[model samples]
Target: MLSTSARLLRLASLLQSRRHWPGAALADALDVEARTLRRDVERLRELGYPVEASSGVGGGYALGRGAALPPLMLDDDEAVALAIALRAASASVGGIEATSLQLMGKLDQLMPQRLRRRATALHAVTLSLRTGTPLVDAGLLSELATACRDGRALRFSYRKHAGETTARHVQPQRLANYGRRWYLIAWDIEREDWRSFRIDRIEGGLQLGDLFAPRPVPPDVAARLERGIAYAPFACRITLRLQGSLEELQAALPLWCGVIEPETTTHSLLRMGAETPEGLLAQVLMIDRAVEVVDADAVASDIGRILARMSSVFSRDGARVAP
Candidate 1:
């Protein structure tokens, strides 16, 4: 049994950790009888903590929203981890501007000098290497995140890579992050389909007419759809024998870039569909590692034409060009 002071601190910590706790479970967690737990609950109430209790199996003890915000409980590691995350999230000028920087500044003022220095050192040493075409509006991001949290449909205009535009009505299911880019997995209302939209390309997001009953999202839905898109519409499928392990190859190329499958312990097959021979050759040559182009003959004629054009350009400049 803990002393009264220790037990009271533990009780406060437990309440702050979660939204609700069943009376029995709370008693067990505190290692005390139900009566003792009740007394402790009363003590908290006397301290101005609004504790609510309900009767039945589903009933539990929960602290209501107080007149003012209460202090949070975080162990050493949790505090350090939160500080690191806040620093990184603040560095980006992205489609969604996060308020983590302002929050970080506020928290730093309250944090011990030792922890503050550690967080500052980590942030100072980190470097970012990503560059993108444009910034995503933070307002639109908040609107979409709010809709997802509230279980609502959204209307938005999406711009494709080719510059074509389309309107989408969707039941926003979940948002995911892949390679610093955000994606929304939603049930498309107009097409009666499930679709994924790149958050960076969404132009206008508006609340729609009706709310949707949420549906189950398939496990690894993003991976499956990205794989499908990699080879779906291209006219030609070319295979390459890459000289690397499956994990290394996957790191170099995203799932949407090519259909990658393992062949053995170290080797893998890359299946890519291309619109033209020129485009196919350009992609194959960019693998950046030792690889054999097994079907070079299929696109050999087009490669020759590309070579001839390159030769003419080099001759005009009188420059030595490496094939």
Candidate 2:
């Protein structure tokens, strides 16, 4: 026979595991009398679980929503998944690192040795490269995520790259992460077009307004966000013909590094942007393969200067050396 406290915990776990449990079946499962089961249900109610009870031939117990969050009961797989996610979030999502780490520690303490070993192995094998991206407030992320989920209109101040500030009202659609930065993809009311707002650039409080009908977002929101970051946010655009597989090109560069299209089975077209022609040229050179300039009108001079420097360095005895 289980003790009172042990029985209560088992009862709670059983209640959480299913939508409904008949009184007789529940008592049978717990190996308890009907009168004792009634007392357990009362105990759960006092603990704010909102466990609803119905009497008669079809009477049973069901856990319903309460005013406050109750203690969660997670199975082995769910516990491991949550631990891994919290660990990743600690490194990727800014402003929540400390909180995530704290939660991760608590979870690690609660997890069994088998689950803990799996979580530890995953963490040991995975590496997160920090990109020095600007920190976004966790509260702001929560607000935006809620707005996106509820189809709410959000009004917030935004800071442009040129140090200009403007007010924006948008219908929140999705929150995406690219290269360590978080972006909010939404329909800008004033601009009357889809826009990607860097979460870090959103200034002041976010005001959630009346609910709006949800709009259709891009099928591949991450790809759309990547393009917006690479081209729309920069001034100097450069297109190059890179001699490499599209998969290889994608793996070599970050998603926001550029947009790539398959030119052939072994070649790809890469379009990228930067604030300056030199900056754009440098990014093109980072690809570890032969590259042909498809369009060099903007960075011709910069490319010429770089070639000249390389020529001088490789030359010996006032003669250009060929490699």
Candidate 3:
């Protein structure tokens, strides 16, 4: 007999494989009693799988349409994903290479020739580097993803950049992966605006809430999240104009450092932030291109103060400061 978790997973797969399942047949297939099957179905529901159940004679459970079931895939894209994911697991995690390889071979044998070619060729070129990023809980990621597919609300404590944690109520819109980190772009129910939350920084367990009506998502969710990250709140936001087009600057600089926008055919605008004006100036000085500070309001004053301080230091101890 399969373990409880494994059985539940099998049940979900069986339910998704077909629209309707007879309760007795499903129970027999799993070699579990009818009571056990019922319990497993309920467990799937709690995990955000929209498992619909019908009671009485000739009734059973069905995995509702649109449920994001990653276990038993029936779609071609999903089959490709399963192959790639197994490969990634073999490369990144320890003690599972052999197991993953065996599973990959089995899945590949079952896949149609076209899909096998696509997944294998794609996996061949991509490199998976273990960068020592924070270990995000896969179960948490799965739950949140299911919530997004179901348009469910979520409540959890989110840690800020400053390390302060606060409660958040949100209607999740989408999950965006930028670089190695995962971010949730959601409508902040408390703040009544859209906000982005880093999945790694979300504390403890999530509290799944009632389903929310779908709202108009941004035309480009990844771009919106990029802007959110680029202009994140800081003591000072530094703006710089440089002699290059946006494309040129973006290719040269790391995305985490700042955002680049077009200004003209020959110029681009850089928007970045630092905790202090001096810190901001230090970052600005690192850029290779000649930059013109473009802060037009109060931030310009702070920049001036930093400039004045630097000038005084350079004059008082030119030899010591520069050399």
lDDT at position 88, candidate 3: 66
lDDT (tens digit, per residue) of candidate 2 on 1-323 = 99999888899989999999999999999999999999999998888889998989888999998889877878788888898888766555667777888888888898889989988888888776755643677888999999999999999999987789999999999888776778899999989988899888998889889899978986877666777778767878878898788898888866656898789998999888888877776777776567787976867777788778878877957787776
State the displacement of the C-alpha of residue 277, model 3, in Å, after optimal TM-score superposition.
2.4
Tens digit per residue, CA lDDT, model 3, 8-87: 76787788788899888999999999888888888878887888888899788787865564445446888888888877
Q: Per lDDT, what order, best first?
A: 2, 3, 1
Off by over 4 Å in 1: 1-10, 18-40, 43-68, 93-98, 127-134, 149-151, 228-259, 262-268, 271-323
Off by over 4 Å in 2: 1-78, 117-134, 218-222, 243-248, 264-266, 313-323
- Candidate 3 has its poorest 10 consecutive residues by lDDT at 88-97
All candidates' lDDT scores? 0.75, 0.84, 0.80
User: Comparing candidate 2 with candidate 3, which one achieves the higher TM-score?
Assistant: 2
Candidate 1 per-residue C-alpha lDDT over 130-241 given as tens digits, one digit per residue, 9 for 90 to 100: 6544345556667778888888888888986557889888999887665556678888888987788877788755746577787989887866555545654566557778
TM-score, every prediction = 0.70, 0.71, 0.57
